[model samples]
Every structure is written in structure tokens, then in C-alpha cells.
Target: MIKIILLLFFSLNLIGCKKSEPVKSAEKDDKYGDYYVESSIGDATYLNPILASDSASGDINNLIFNGLVKYDKNIKIIGDLAESWSVSEDGKIIIFNLKKNVKWHDGKSFTAEDVEFTYKKLVDPKVKTPYSSDFEIVKKFEIINPYKIRIVYKEPFSPGLISWGMGIIPKHIFEKGDFNTHPANRKPIGTGYYKFVEWKTDEKIVLEANSDYFEGRPYLSKYIYRIIPDQSVQFLELRNETIDSMNLTPDQYNAYKSYFKNYSKFKYPTFGFTYLGYNLLNQLFNEKEIRQAIAYSINKKEIVDGILLGYGLPATGPYPPTSWAYNPEVKDYEYNIEKAKNIFKKYGWSDYNKDGWLDKDGKKFEFTIITNQGNKSRSVACELIQEHLKKVGIKVNIRILEWSTFIHQYVDKKNFDAVILGWNLSRDPDQYALWHSSQKKEGQYNFVNYENKEVDKLLEDGRRIFDEKKRQKIYQRIHKILADEQPYTFLYVPDALPVIHKKFTGPEVAPAGVGWNFREWYVPYEQRKYEMSK
Candidate 1:
């Protein structure tokens, strides 16, 4: 669930040089120069792809690592490190033909052994990673040679092929130490388009183009990721031309349409949704009716229209409307304060003391909703929900914390009443890590502690079946059940509004957004601005 936001920026010229033209040539030698600078709200916690769950780490990891497989511009599964692959007729075994001449950043050879080591570490019970579920079903991993490998699965896992898309760790570097505390986590060495150069805590992360890259040297000489926690501060930096790229908020996208002439903006629906997930461990939220009542109390349309400024759609379930598994028949709870009040009364929540706040068993009905700081949209949405719930005789409090603290301390530990967060979904519909009852352990995505026997069976069945049609039906059933259960009051799917500076080019408006061909994106020598030190 790592949200990848592509932010490409251009440098402003002080003299009277004309704006840079779009990249039109396919020649790689002539297109290399300049540095692209982007901004992030939080600093990366871990650069190691396996343990990095937050978006900040994901953004950097995408540049510093290469997966065995990757999604193409059309969101189709394609080869990355692997040149090609074949699957058995039973769909339980796969053979991967890895690309030759690939080398890790430290000049070490990348071979089948590295892939095998990464798989072992991923499924190691001692490792604290949420991605273990994806690889746990592997029956056997056999290395045919340095450049070839065969994998046997316990069953026909529908998401098996794409799960190899997880980044491969270098065996030589990680084998001798505790991987969870490895110093290389901050200074990663990967066989990728970029090489990690520096990571200044809470300040910036710098990466240089990998000259020895197997595919080809990247066009941009450097990639700078700046950490600016506040959205308003990020906009100020954008206005001053300090940063080249950012994901503009809905209000910013609509308000600054004509302001930046040298920048190109693209808007598309995101493959994710925001939600208010209740911690089922809390006794207050354990009741299904009370959860449904909370869902009915809030107005999703208000959030989409008011907070999102109509740049999003109200989410009905876990999957976005764009997903094939999304069940259009699953209806959201209508905004009904009276109905919510009735449901609360049925649960013995009432203002017995004539106070506005509801009380039952000598305790007031109240809970705190925690969300990460610097996200204005989620904060405002929480405020709106607080107002709406108060009308239904529920007192609510909101707590905003830093991104690292929010995830590590509050979310992973299950020490909160509720959380207003978002999930950046994968292309495949298998949600075993997020909803299956067995995945409720620490560091797992199922932090809400939602457990349904039917959901567990459906998720298992969905993964074992490969037919798109059959998997679609199973996921639709899951969507319907989750919508009815109300484990999360699914909120909205916002549009991805990313603006890129015009000096750098080669960006396209494809189904996977503009960054799929990032290695090819470049700036002409004439238009080059920032120079990197050796």
C-alpha cells in the first residue's frame, strides 16, 4: 500500500532563455542532464523495500530498487529484473529467466542466489514486515543457475506472479547482520536506475543516476526529495520555484490552474481511498450496529464536495470504482442523523443527564480519532466528522501526530480508538494481508482487528483461483460483506493531481500515470539548470 507520487520539476532561468521544449528524440546520449527536485510531507523511515510501509519510504525505494517484475504504463505485469518468465500448467510453479550483466550498486553481481535470499528473509518469522503473507505460501525455491530460478507454490495463488514485484535485496550485504537494524537500510545499494547518495534526517534525500545500470543510465543526473511537512509550506516552496514537483491538493489544483505557465499538470483518479477505520479491539466499536450508525452519521458527499472540492468520488467499499472487483451494488450508508440517534439509543446510549453528550453505564460515549500531521485533507475530514457526530450525541476528539509516530507507535501497537487514514491499493484484488483474520498481528495492515470467518474463506478462495471472472465475483462478495460490516467508514477516492516542471520531459499520461518511464525522462543540455557534485 505504498502511495507513489511522481513529482518532476523545472529550473527557472534568471536570464532571457526560452522555456525548455519537450523531449522529442529517442537518443539517450543527448538527453542526459539537470536534476529533478520533488517534495514529500514526511521523511523516509526505512529505505529497505521490505520493511518500508509508509509512502515516504516507498517513494525513495521505487528509485533505489528494482523488482523482478513491474507494472507497465498500462498497468500490466511486465518484466523488470527478470527478462522473461514461464508458469506451469497447474499455475503452481514458475520459472524466471533473470536479466544478465545486472550488478548491485556496490559493484556486486546480482544472481539467483540474491533472489532466493530475499525470499527467505521475507518469509522469516523473526522479520517484522507486513509483506510476509505474500511469500509464505512458497513450497520451494530452486536455483537452476546464476541467472535462472524456479519457484513452486503450495497452491495456485492468483497474485503469485505479481508478488515477485517486491524488490530483491542483495544477499551479500544483508546476510551477516540483523536485517531489521542494518545500517545499509539508510544507505541502500540496489540494482536500479538510481543509487542512493545521501539521506539527511527530516531534511532531504539525494540520489544520483546509476551509470552502470543494466537497462541504461538514467537521463537525470540527480533526484532530490525534499521534506516539507506542511502543505502550505510546500506550496510556498513551489511558488518560489524552490521545488520542481508536488501533488497539489484539490483546492490548490483548482486555484492555481493558470498561475504556473512553465509547469504541466495532470489529473487522474487515484487507485486508493481514505477511510475512518475503527479499532475493533475497542469495546465501543465492537458492535456492528454502532459501527453502521457511525457510518450513517457522517456525510461522505459533504467530504467529497466540501473538503475535496469535487475532485474525488465518495467511496462505497474497499476497492475504488476503477477496480474491476469494486461492487457497484454495495450502497453506502445515507446521511441520517436521526437514524444514527435511534441506533445509539438501541445500544443504550442516551443523554440521561440531559447533557448533549450520550452516556451509557455511567460513561460518556466518546473516542479520539488519530491521523498523521501535515495532511490537511484528513485533518479537515476528521473535524467535519467530529461536528457531524456531535449532532448525534457523540463527543469526539482528534489527535494529529507525525507520520513515523502515527504508524509505529499508535497504529502498529493498536493503541487508538479510531484512525483516519488511507490505503494505496495494489492492482491485484487479493486483500489477504489487509482483511484476513490471521493477519491481525503487529505491523500487519489489518490494524483494525476486523475478523470474519466468511471473509477469511473468500480471501483464501480468491487467491487460489486464477480466473479473472471468478476472482472478480469473489472480491465483489468481499466488498459487499465489508460494506455491510462497516469495519471502516470508507470515505473518498481523490484525484491524483501532480504537476511537473516543463524543463524535464518524456512524461506521458498513461494508465499508470507519468512515472512508469521515469528512467527515460530527461532534460536537454541547453535547458539544464542544477549541476550535481561528483
Candidate 2:
């Protein structure tokens, strides 16, 4: 599903310490020697951008690769590998002028052929990727020359330009091997600021700065990604200066606001929402009334207050309030136990045997809700939901598995009754990849098996339209329909609480969040801690 599992942290915590003053030095004075160490809850599943869907992989991919276009700090589409591009008058054809000087990490010259190869691989039937939908609408991909390429869409696909932001893979290295099981999937070669050094499974992944990078060498010499599944353990590492950054849990954000002396904490509303998704294929969840009942029974406010420590807003639909597509008029299912029980009773559920739990067709109203391990907020939210559902004569079981196992074995297989997960959204509002009926196949994002013909049409129409006002209406309608359908009990939009060591400079919070200017971030030679190494 291209699910973003990257831990995002936001609210600024500056209660005890004063903000560090900006360095009174020129650009030439910037030093590049220290390392920026960060932690993730899970290890990356694949370094290959096309095959990788999880956010753990995304974190590393962002450093190791570049797309034709990328989002700037203001959330606007800007050039990355491509220097510029122009769309046809009809908006179907786009010609990109690729950067001529870019070099792949393996020292190969990057050209239009690489971008063309990446597009072909994305639509290739043998490749197992969740991102195929984005490129499937393309009618043609043509390489005009060594540094120029053209893309013709089947129609005026609204997300056509931005979809190229998918990481461009190197054709030279991948052409000889099976793209799915390519050796580079584990150890990738790319044109980004960082070059892959080593990946020790379930432990750490390391990369060194590319001196010949087209945009100029990254000021930070090394980028170290450590896998510490437990948030508490990550916090301990952050406190000891072993790791430079991590997303702080709400409790950690609230209670330890003034604890860190050498760290800068940041918090902002994330563009994602957590949800309780049901397996629609399950007989128990196939009924819309049952899903609605479950939604009504959940106390979303309680989750926001208790687990999030009032750091988040209850979600009513797929888009957060920050999104242009968010439907403000679509009301959420109120937390009402009596309404939920009445709906259950109307749907043939009853305590026929005089037991505390409700039953239908001699089967008890019981189901398990699973989420990834180490995310204490989700586990605690599950406990609260278990209590809420129990009060409504439903028995809810909670299971926490390691991240990779949970996604591959359970989520991808649809071998789960229900799951608590979040979607890291793109700035674009076209949700065809996540909600379309055709996307339910294995390795696709529609893991819940949600299918609605009306939604299918709406998603298609939404992508074909280009006008802002028209597209806004289309997505708003989709939001309302999904809100009423209750395929997922849309949960909350939690504030991102990222904390970073204060030694490095150049991070700035913008509309696109921090880390957009990561290449420019540097530590002064006097403050450098780690030595440069391959």
C-alpha cells in the first residue's frame, strides 16, 4: 500500500533551553564531517524504491535515490533529477529535460534511459509493486535523447506530473538481474546525496555522502539509520547521544519536554491518519451495519486524550483537516454505546445464551485487532478500543507483531480480522492507489478488500479532472461516501514529535515539514563528533 511507517515527530519543545543562535558564518565556512544518526521502529524491507512500500524503506530510499521531480519546502512540485519540464497544451504529454551532469552512486552516468527504464519496470506485469497504478495511466514513455524524455498520459491525469517523483532506478545495474530479486534491492545504487555503505539486517543501515553529487556534496558526511523497534529504547539512545534523532511518543513529548539539553524537539500536525480497517472479505465484517456499529462504539476522543495526550485531532475521513480535500461537512460517528448496541440488535446480534457477549448464528461477537509492535500509542489505543467494544457486548483481542511480519504475513495476505494502521499521504489528493477495487491484489495498497463501484468511478473521475475546484468537489464526495461506508473507523491525526540533536544546523520547518533541506544541514568543525569514513 506504500504505507508510510516512518515515525514523524513535530511539536517544538523549548521549555527549559533557549534556541541555538544561527551560526554567524558564510556558506564557505560550512564543515562536513559529523554523522546524523536516527532510529526507526523497523528495518527496511527493500532498498529498491519500486518494490518498497513501507516507510522504513522510504526513509532510506529518500537518501539513496532521486526522482525526476520532488516537493520543495513549500510543498510545491520542483525539479530533482530533471532540470525542467513542459506539459503539452492538452496536458497529456510532458517532456522533461534531465540533468546532464548527474552520476549514479556506482559512478555510471545517469541519463534519460534510466528514467524510461524505471517507468517501464513500474508498469511491467512481473514487478510486484504498489505504485504501478500511478504509472499505469501513461500511454507512452519515449526517450528523445540522452538527457530528454517524454511521457504521454492516457488522459489528463491530475497527478501525472507529480507521480514522476517516484524514485528513478539505475537501468545499468538492474537490467541483468530479476528486477524483483535484484541484488541492488538490498544494496542500491542511485544519484541521491548519499551512497549505500552497508545494511546489517535488523540492526542498522549506513550511507556516506557522495562527493560528486550534482547538487553539491551533502554537508553531513554520514547518515546512520539504526533499528530500535521500541520507542522507549530509542529515547534512551537519544538521551545518551548514541542516536541523534527519533519520533517521541506523546507521553515522552508531554512529560519530558524540558529534559533534553542537547536536543531540539519539533511538533506539527501530520498529513496522515490512523484507522481501524476491517477485512471486508470476512463474513463478520462484510455487513455495513456491523462496521458502523463498531465505529460508533469506538471512543476516538478518549484515544486522542489518553493515548495522544491531547496532541491529535479525531479523524472523520481519509484526508486530515490540513488537506484541501478534507470534507468538513462529513460528520464522524459519535461515540454512543446505546446506538451501537441497538444497531447490533437490529442486525440479529443478541445474548441468546444469557452470556455477557453478543452472538449471531451461534457465533460469539469476537475479533482480533492487530498492529505493529513498539508503537505504544497504537497498542494502548487497541486496549482502549477493547474496553469500549467489550462494553457493547463485543470481544476484541489485540495482537502486536514485529513490523515486517505484520505487513507481509498479515496485511498483504489479508489474513487479519482488523488492523490499526496509518497512511502516510502524498500531497496529491488522488487516492486511486489506496481505495480502488482493482488495487486489492497482493502487494497493492487496498489491503482491506474494500470495493465500491461508485467509489471506483469517483476515483477514476477524480484523477482525470484537472481544475482545482472540480477536483475538490470530487474528493469531497469520496470522503463523504467513505465516511458513511465505514470501511475504516478513521481515528486521529497525531502531531509529529521529532527530536534532533542540536549540534547540526539548517533544519527549518516549512509547509512540507523539516528535513527538506537536509543536504545543506551541517555541523561546525568544532562541534563535529563523528569522523569521516567509508
lDDT of 1 by residue, 61-172 (tens): 8888888888777877778889999999888999999999899999999999999999999999988888988899999999999999999999988888988888899999
List residue ranges in candidate 1 displaced over 4 A.
1-29, 532-534
- All-Cα superposition RMSD per candidate: 4.9, 4.2
- Each candidate structure's TM-score, on Cα atoms with residue i matched to residue i, is 0.94, 0.95
| Number of clashes recorded per candidate | 1, 13
TM-score, candidate number 2: 0.95
**Worst-scoring 10-residue span by lDDT in model 2:** 10-19
Residue-level lDDT of model 2, residues 50-90, one tens digit each, is 99888788888888888888877777787888899999877
RMSD of 2: 4.2
